[model samples]
Target chain A: MDWNAFLLSLKLAGWTVAILLPLSVFIARHLAWRRYAGKAFVEAALALPLVLPPTVLGYYLLVGLGRASPIGQLYEGIFGGPLVFTFEGLLIASIIFNLPFAVQPMQRAFENISEEIRDAAACCGMTSWRKLWRIELPLAWPGLMTAFVLTFAHTIGEFGVVLMVGGSIPGETRTAAIAIYDRVQAFDNAAAGAMSALLLVISLIAIGIANLATSRAGARRG
Target chain B: MADRPTGLDARLVQDAPIPLNARLRCEPGEVLALVGPSGGGKSTILCAIAGLRNIAEGRISCNGSVWYDSEKRINVATRLRRVGFVFQSYALFPHLSALANVMEGLGSGRNGGSERRARELLELVRLGGLETRRPSELSGGQQQRVAVARALARDPEVLLLDEPFSSVDRATRQRLHRELGHLRGRLRMPIVLVTHDLEEAVQLGDRMSILHHGQTLQEGAPHDIMARPANREVARLIDLKNIFQARIAGQRPGAGITALAWGSTRLEAGYNRRFAVGDLVDWVIPSGSVILHRRRRPSRGIRENPVHGRVESMVRLGDTVIVAVKVDAHAGYPLFMSMPVHAAERNSVAPGERVGVSLVRSDIHIMPALQPDGHDDANADP
Candidate 1:
């Protein structure tokens, strides 16, 4: 296994988690607090990627980022090339594929917070923005971290989305999971086994760190 | 207390058309307890004055400044209104320490250090050492003290406490009550306390107002309210145990006369001009006002309003004995007469034994029956 692929996988997971954390918080707040028309529809749409086949998501991304499409045209116009079959396209696909993993836990966390606490903040005369930044976000930090971890781990282990959109571009888009698959396809069983072992260790350590952080937060709240 | 400004003077009207009008001028260092049942709009009144609720009609002016006015479309946000509010649930930030919670409202401009001011306020509430603890780490009483400290950090002109002691244990409630009494003495701001407990109202309020169905039924000093309720409902709310229907038999120049016709006995009572001849009126004799004797004794000063009865039941509460008397003369209901436990024990009175119940004419408060619309203007006085 190439060490570069492992490093690239780690970088991809890191970027995904960073971008998804704030987005998930915003989505959770909207789902939990705001009342809007078509909320149910919007929620269902956001969650569609969770159950839909990864190949389906990858296919949609491929077409959306292809030269003919608006997003693809904009990308090509800005960056001088199509986004399909590129590393950036692979990251986009993984984000979409893992969105539900990022959002669901956060939504549940925000839902469990009693409205009495929010009303208390309002009565304290804090503005909405201040309340969100100072009160709600701080209290909801553990759930946000959980969402980030799940999204990052899920993105790291993604194969189908990368295979379809990234086309196994070595050291660029071929993450560890995709590298293991390629090794297995080429009948390099020894290399595949080594990459699988590394992926397992990384994922286990990520999960352990996440659990420790969450438990510490829980103790503080308690 | 440097001639502190008058307290809350506000009228509130919600989307529901009935306007809740309140005009109060409490001196500095006064505790005004607003007592009412749930949904009587007691808390709503507090919110309106605190600028937390929008009023569709009328104005709210506190400390000589207009906080809100619907007609003029003038409204001040709650934070800018300079009023402190303590919620029933305390509303302390769970993530913040007790000191931090108190300091959160001190606004960045206070001359002294924020921590020092927070500590001073906490000390005022007797929670000086609990600064590092979170809300969940403290008992209900401690949490409420922190909330009170937080409210005081703003140095508000008016402090609004909504059932501040309701969530604490009885023992803690008594302690908080005493602490609150002390705090009221030290602070120059007027405090408006909302509660549904009559005893709490009496103990905490310098002057109390009783609200029913979104309208104030009566307002006055606690002793005055208990002794001279404006009507039967007010009497009932104050726990007047003996209410009897009587008819105005006749009217005299300075005092009117009425006959309280029970089943087989009739008692005479002195009334005022508010009573008309043949008018059906209800009168209340509070349990504390009833005197009970074991043997048939000669009538004393106000013997005209006297009746004989058998003790139907006896219930002991603290040091008082509440005895229910079966007055066969009163057709529909049995009369409840109360006696002190020591008096009952000295007289050796028990249930099913005969006793004489006597009340003074001054003890008999008579009023016209409640209107069919249930409109009792008992809260008009402050």
Candidate 2:
């Protein structure tokens, strides 16, 4: 079943979620409340990954993080390694592609919060940090849960970006989706079918959890 | 109250984001009502006082401290300013219990005695036993009380209520009004109330400011503003509907009367020296001051400003009946008056019936016309 590759996929998804969800909260909050010039442009730029082909995005990231690039040179100077074909590179690719999935739901949730409620919180003598921790985070819980689940599931099932940014390397960057593809090319139909079934079950469970969170949020609004 | 000037004093002027050119002052233990139509900058003024909204040129001072000073380039953050704001929606935290909501205003469980203080505040708002209930579980009035308790927990320098009674039912609003009136006696801070309902302002405000088109037209006692508005716009805003164009005939200082020429009739009003002889002006009188002559016998008091008219329209609303009378000399315009239903019944007042009405002389008020000769045709002799 390529268990090592499956475990590596899980690890990559977990890291992507852990690093992106918290950061998305702040970014989503800023987008929700602020009004400025070119706000729609900024939002469209952030959502570019949703519509662009994964290979296209991967090509840009590959060139940007290659050994000749300034970012790649800086990373090598810090960690003594190039960044294009390792698990870390794959993690970066996963985070970038999952940005829309992580941000849009949380932004909608933050926007649903009444401005009067936030004003009342400030009038109650609560500092901005305390208000965010006590009021905003609790009210936006469902969206956070939805963002976490979707990002994890999407990162695990990613194929094109992973193949482009991080080539298949056993116990390193070879993920479950890549393993299924490799098994099919080798005429190992039985292994491919079993791994595909596992991926389907996992995807269904993640979607179910995400829908549950969304419906709960909808009920609160209703 | 403190010895020095220790209440809210603000003058805000800005062009965008809800235009405002308002000046407000409320002494400690006093309530100032900002009454105007919708989108007239009432709520914007309240927000400016709370530091929730900014102004281009203004200085807001409360309790002898500067909250915002444009000249000095100082603007205090909302939280740092000691202000309690009750929104129009009564925005209580839906997830928190009543006690926790009140405790949140006490620095969110920071003070040593916050819990005890919160409980006492809840009790003060008459929500003692409902401490464990979330906002969703409570009724509208109960939620408003919780919001009020939370607002009071911080012991703010000024209290800003942006139509706190607007969202509740009529009965609940009356009860809240009475409770707020009682609560006002115990509060030692300036309170600014924003409302579009003139009756609510009259009932709650110690002084009222009339705003229109982002400008404060006048500020005075509620009754005074109603009885004697600053201009035609103020009169119209307060719903004083018996406005008419008149020419000043003469001012009898010795008799304490100002004579006005209305069509072919001369009417007497209380002495006002501001308008010179032959000057054109607009005048208004309260609907309650128009007394109908009794059918059986006329009193000497009803002999003043006697004018004959036919009842044009009569509308009965609650305990009062509004009667519009078309004067014989000026048939185009109608004079409106409100009388008790029982009085209307006693006089047999009905549409198409001839009636004699005497406008009370002392109640007539005069102000400059908004548009010169706007309604001059209506007041011409028929």
Candidate 3:
């Protein structure tokens, strides 16, 4: 396995999560509380990538942001190159593909918080931000941790979208999921097995730790 | 403590599944028990007062400051309204310990002193040693106390309680009542307590407001309202189950007595209204106001408001004994009477035995007969 590609994969997941976590939380919180026209449409749009083939999403991004389109040309004018097959392109693809993975759990968490607690805080004269930081976030800690872990793990497993948008550019877009496929196609069964096993172990540990922490938090609430 | 504690004045209207139009007031240093049955807009009144819910019309003010004025289109947000609201569920933050829950109400203004004030409040509620426990770890009563402490930490101008004691056990409710009575003395601010329990209202309210279906039927001191409900509905709400349909026999306006025709007999009761002769009226006397005589006293000696009767049924509850007596003079319904067990023991009262029951002259109250709508005054247009 190429250590550079492995390191780049971790970096890609890290950047994708760093950008998506806060964005998803805010979006999910708004969805949980507020009602407006076209809300259902917006929600369905956000969740579409979850069920859509990653290759299809990647195909749209590849064309829509590929220098020939207005946004792509505008970006190219600034950066002197098209967005496809770039590290930045891979991050954008990963964020779109994993949007629901970051939102649904957090939204459910916020919704699950008892209205009594919210009313209590409001009546007691706490500011909205204080209520969110002091009461809501702590109580919804398990869901937040789960959302973060899932987003990170999902980004690590980017295969089709990464292939379509970031096209195996060695250090730029060769994530672990893509790297294992590359090794298999090159007829190196030993390398493919090793990469696949490593990825599986890491993903299991990430989810297991999140699950264990969530149960601990639930017990404390009891 | 505020030198001039805030009083409350509000008139709210809501046009929803059920229309509501309520007007209420409470002076500083007073507990106005807002009493009614479930779904009678008791909680709605409290919510409107605290700004937790909005009203379609009318004004809300605390002392001199107008919190909401629909005409002016000036509505203060709930966070801006200086109100301490204790919800029925005692909504304590589950993740925060008791002390921290109280401290959260102190706002960002008190950084260093919040912990001390929160501790002082917990100690006030007698939860000093258990300050570290979360709401889930505390008993229902303790959680309610914590919620109270948290609400008061803001030093609010108005206090609203939404059946704050309803969830606790009977023993805990009694303890909480005593604690609330004590708190009232120190609070000295306007309080609006929503309760479906009539006994609680009578015991704790300096003044009581009786509501039905979102409209306030009557408001006065508890005893005054109880003795003189505006209509039959108000009478029923106050647990006055012994309403008799009596007609006006004669009027002695200067003597303050309106003679009423109770089934086959005439009895004169203290009357405030100038009810004309021959006009029908409903006379009410509370069950506890009836005095049972061991034997038939002579018609001349203390015969005022006296009726010979036979005991029909008896129920003993602790120190209190409730007896139903069927009067011989009237073929009408039996009169339910409640007296102390000792009083009954002295009279040796038993079911199937004959007895004499009379009203304490001052206890007999008379009201205008029910109109078709059960309202003394004509109702609004349909």
Candidate 4:
């Protein structure tokens, strides 16, 4: 069953979401509300990973964070380990790869909050933190939930980027998707089938939950 | 510094994205209605005072507290400014219950019994039992009441209402108006209301400001502005229908008469010395001030600025009939008069019929003419 690989996959997905969700909340909010020069270009750059070949992205990550790169050397000097082919490297890769999945839904959620509602909040004497905690967070919950679920599931099922950035080290970097691929390559059909079924069910459940939340939110708003 | 500012005082000047050159003042317990046409920057003025909008150069202060000053660079954040604003759409949080929405405006920190205060506010707005219902669960009028209650929860120094009654039906608007009237008696803050409906402005405003193309042309009591607009544009804006160009023939101050040359006919008006004897001017008399002469009667009012005209159009609006008379002295100009349907029927007034009318001299207001090619005041010319 490759239990270590499956647990590692869950851990990577967890860490990726924990880091990306908070960061995406701020980024998505800024994109939704503020206007600036080159805003369209910035958005297009953020969405680049969505359409680019996973292997191409992986190659860039390899060069950008490999042992020979400055960032890779700095991390190795500080942590006594190379940046690539480690759990941390895999987590970083997962976050970057899932940027669109994590941010677009949250951006749309923030955009759905009408300008009048925000103006009313300001006029009500609510501070920035209070407005976010009391009003924005509650109203944008469904999109945030959808973002978490999609990012988690996509991170778990990723293959090309994971393989390119984190070479399949058995317990450190070999996630569930890599384990499935390894089993197929080794002619272990039974193991491959079990892992594939698990991933398929997980993805379907995630999508189903996201759809339920969005539809409920839509009905409530209606 | 001679007079301590007690309420809101603001002057805004901007050149882009809805140009504004407006200034307004309202004392405590006074309602200043900003009445203008659509796209006239009425709402923008309210937003500027509330600190929701930015003006290129301006100073806005409420109760002696400076909310925005471009020269001093002292722009206060909207949350720090104590303003209770009621938007046209209400803008209630759809996720929260009515009670929670009101509670949100109380500001965090004093937690004990804030819920009670919210409930009391709801009760004040006549939504006592519906506190737990969400905005979507309430009717449009009910939602608006909740919005008002929420705004009041801020305990603000100024209340800004932006077409608050526009979205509701006529009956609901009337009821809301009555409720607002009732509510204002207890309020001690200045209130700024923006509306395009002149009738609504006249009914609610202690003073009304007429705006056009982002400029405040005049501000005064509604009755005074309607009776005597400051200029030709204001006359047209207030729907004064009997406006015509005339030349001053003579001014007899002792007799309280200003003779105007209306084509070949000389019409007497109340003495106004603002214009010289040879000056061209524009004059207006409200429809109500144009008295229709009864058939076969030489009434004493006929001795006033009497005129002969043919009725061009007769429109019956419910109990009143509006008769547009084409004056014989001025070929293209028409004088409009309105009277009870019975009075109109008794006079046998109909289209294409000739009639005599009298323009009340005291009611005829004269203003400097606008430029021949543009809306700029003719007074600007040397």
Clashing pairs in 1: B216-B379, B217-B378, B217-B379, B218-B378, B218-B379, B262-B329, B263-B329, B263-B330, B264-B329
Which stretches in model 1 have alpha-carbon errors above 4 Å? A35-38, A63-68, A74-80, A122-130, B1-5, B15-27, B39-41, B44-59, B70-75, B109-112, B255-271, B294-299, B372-382
Q: DockQ, per-model, please?
A: 0.41, 0.65, 0.68, 0.79
TM-score of chain A considered alone, across all candidate predictions? 0.94, 0.94, 0.94, 0.95
Model 4 regions more than 4 Å off: A219-222, B1-4, B373-382
DockQ, ranked from best to worst: 4, 3, 2, 1
State model 2's lDDT.
0.90
Regarding DockQ, does 2 or 3 come out ahead?
Answer: 3
lDDT of 1 by residue, B1-382 (tens): 4764476676665645435655555656888888877887888888788776676787888877888988889998877788788988887888888888887767542345988989898888898788899999999999999988888888888888999899988999999999888788789988889999999999999998888766778889998998878877888777777766665666665645566543346656665777677776777777767777445444464364677778878899999888887765654456776778988988878988887777766677777766423321222111
* lDDT for model 3: 0.83
TM-scores for every candidate against the unseen true structure:
0.87, 0.95, 0.90, 0.96
Worst 10 residues of 2 chain B by lDDT: B373-382
Tens-digit per-residue lDDT, B1-382, candidate 4: 4777799999999998999999999989999999999999999998888888899999999888899999999999999998999999999999888999999888754476889999999999999999999999998899999999999999999999999999999999999999999999989999999999999999999999999999999999999999989988898888877777778999999999998987777888899989999788888888888898888776888878889989988888999988888788776557789899999888889999999999899988888876443321221210
Candidate 3 C-alpha error for residue B273, in Å: 3.3
Worst lDDT window (10 residues) for model 4 chain A?
A: A213-222
Docking class of 2: medium
User: Clash number for every model?
Assistant: 9, 0, 0, 0
i-RMSD per candidate, Å: 2.1, 2.2, 1.3, 1.3
